[model samples]
Target: MIKLLSLLALLWVYMAVVGATHTADLSRKSFPKGFLFGTATSAYQVEGMASKGGRGPSIWDEFIKTPGAYFSFFKHLLEDINLMVNLNFDAYRFSISWSRIFPNGTGKVNRKGVAYYNRLINYMLRKGITPYANLNHYDLPLALENKYLGWLSHDVVKDYADYAEFCFKTFGDRVKNWMTFNEPRVVAALGYDNGFFAPGRCSKAYGNCTAGNSATEPYIVTHNLILSHAAAVQRYRQKYQEKQKGRIGILLDFVWYEPLTRSKADNYAAQRARDFHVGWFLHPLVYGEYPKTMQNIVKDRLPKFTKEEVKMVKGSFDLIGINQYTTYYMYDPHTSPPKDLGYQADWNVGFAYERKGVPIGPRTKLYEEDILCVQAYSNWLYNVPWGLHKAIMYIKERYGNPTVILAENGMDDPGNLTMSKALHDTTRINYYKGYLAALKQSVDEGANVVGYFAWSLLDNFEWRIGYTSRFGIVYVDFKTLKRTPKMSAYWFKKILRKNK
Candidate 1:
């Protein structure tokens, strides 16, 4: 609680400094017509009914519950929809739990699971909230993981496509915007490289994970995820999309990399960070191959796609969803390459929050009282709002400004914050204000960003961090499952109303 108060104070001071320099004009009227403004949540994160209604256990069930425990959200279905209506949000981007849909990985359909999603979708539509359905977040079915090691095996390409096809056939009619996967890079990196996330896999050099070859598994997992994504896109284009008239895409997380100095080494290091982060996925989808920096560094450890896979993966999406939250400064430390190889080490660059004793932005404050969003737990989430501007501009300059969506952008507070303090949420409001101003500036400069969705709609279970982090605009009392909109939620409601 003291930490929360300190963060709130630091954020207030930062906002004052930012406001003095760049007056943010973030009214909804700034966006073009048809620009989507909404919030998001995933099934596993929010929908708690894990065991009932014929739903099978996901890897998260096995990993989080540590032995596959169950939970439920069935009773709150209508009440949640009613809450969305009250918020006056125009859209909602959520995910479908794979284990809930096909409990045993691929053979049989869970009719109860289907009915649950159908009910959720029907009610959202009835309440006039457009649904942007993502096929997968990080919740892989435990059955698949046990059978074929999940994403590491080529077998997953067909299995994932088969699952995606089931979804398209069933819910494509209602979901106009389809995202194949959310943050696959995070899935590969956090899950396989550091073992910080589910399934707990990492090389011994990286973490105390039970079993994983971080050097090799991250690359292998990413290759299969890319394949799975392309296959699903192909299925949609070849079969359902023509009839359904809906757009299909994938969600990627990007953190803008700024050079610590104007020196050539720092510039190159920054490029390498961007290449290893965004280019790891976007490059393949756009140019049919890995970025030159990645290709040169990762070498054979990075999987290569066959001629058929290349053609299928390229131009795989009608639009791309980028989840941007923060930025960092990268510099070449001139360090020797290590014998132990892992995804993070492959970058060959050093990260810094400051240079010459000056912080990158006010958000770089790491003082215990001033630290925001995971504190030093995640130093990368510094409040560099201009980074969003740079990120969108980078996409335009490099990737041809293809249709884009700011799918996820928000910071978290410690979950133990008092209810009154949580409802105030001035820091979160300022986060939206500053970031949206940056986004608006990017759009004004001819960046073809068409939509923006805040990182989340409601506070629920955050993966790994679990209930320890609160990133939602709406507050949920876990003890009673009560919903309370924060000041930011009311802010969005008012601004969104003004534009409409």
Candidate 2:
């Protein structure tokens, strides 16, 4: 009880420092007409029935068999969707697991797997919640990786298209909004370069893995991923975009990089990081080639797109999903040119959470209650809401303001915190309030922003860190799988209510 009271007191102080002074005079009406208010969840992060319903394995299935891996979330779809309805959300953005639909990757479709999503999607529309379906979210079918090394090979471009075409033919009638891939940069960098994600492969100089050429594989994999996205977009436009009247796009994660100080070197370094990060993908999609900076730095290692490939790869979307999270200060370290190289090392920049003792934002972590909790459950996600506004404007100015969706945004609370404390998540409430206000500000500034989806509807699983990190507005007791709405959830409900 003493601990509970202390948490409440800390939250009050934290709220005052960050965002409590700003009244949430904004609501769903605050956004543009036809702009949506929703929440997001990926299948792998929430669905646990990895082997059920004739589902085939994805690389994640094998990866989670690791000793510390937490077990699954597919059982609660109906209950979870119902929660969305009760919360007054306008839509739900979720992914279709590739292995679940085509277990062997390409040869045959899983009827049971298709039926499950059919039920979920149908129910979402029936309840007045729009269904925004994303085709892939990092869970590539394991068979594809085994057969042809997945994204590393050009073969993936065709296989991925076939799978996507099947999905369009099957589900496109009802699911009007679609996304091709989610965060392909993370797919290439973390999976191949740093080896933090599944299908982990890296050179010894980069990460722990049995065998991988970190310098080469990341570029090759990203090239193939770009081709895959373009191929899927082409197929959708040719076959289903007209008949079904559906829209397709890809989701890219962006971190706003502010220069640490007034130094020219720091500003240039920050630009370099931005170019290598989002520009790595967006430049190719927009202009049919890599950014000039990337071309000059990466040189021959970055693959060239032939004339036909370039035509297919460029201007390949009806919308862009931007997952903006936190911000960091970047500066050029001016280190000596590397001998043993890798993709990440190419950035040649330093990241600082603080400058001259002023912290970047708040660092709310597992046991740092002694100080103000600015760190979230994930070490990387500091609560810096203003970053969202800067990132959206950058996309507006840099990428032609193509229709954008704020796909994933929110911070996590430490899982070990007591349910009472976790439910009274005033910090999470203020986090959304500040970030959403920033989002609205971007729209007011003439950014072509279409919608905003909270990172999650409920806490399910956090990869690598397992269940230790909880990111849902609705709390889940991992032991019992019971769902409870935190204070943040009710706050969001009020904002999203149609009458408001």
TM-score of each: 0.94, 0.95
Over the stretch 1-500, how does candidate 1's per-residue lDDT look in tens digits?
A: 98787778776776565574453456678898888887888888888767777878888887777432212356777876777677777788989999889999899999988998899889989999898999999999989999989998999999999999999999999888999999999999999999988788999999989999989999999999999999999999999998999999999999999999999999999999999898999999999999988888889998999999999999999999999988889999999767899999999899988779866655543445324332212345677788899999999999988999999999777788788867877667777877888898899999999899997888878877778778889888888878889998898877777432
Q: Score each candidate by Cα lDDT.
A: 0.85, 0.86
Which digits, one per residue and each the tens of the lDDT, describe model 2 over residues 1-500?
Answer: 98877777666657554654275587888887788889998888887778778889888777667421333555677788889988888899999999999999998889999999999899888888899999999999989999989999899999999999999999999999999999999999999998999889999888889878888899999999999999999999998999999898999999999999989999988998999899999988988999888888888888999999999999998899999889999988878647777788888899999989977887744344444354576778777777889999999998899999999999888878889878888777778878888898899999999899998888867776778888999999888889999998999878777763
Candidate achieving the largest TM-score: 2
The residue pairs in collision within model 2 are: 48-72, 48-73, 48-74, 362-374, 363-374, 363-375, 364-374, 364-375
- After superposing candidate 2, which stretches have Cα over 4 Å from the reference? 1-16, 19-21, 66-73, 364-374
Error of 2 at 459 (Å): 0.7
Candidate 1: lDDT of 399? 92
Cα error, candidate 2, residue 123 (Å): 0.5
Q: Give the TM-score of candidate 2.
A: 0.95
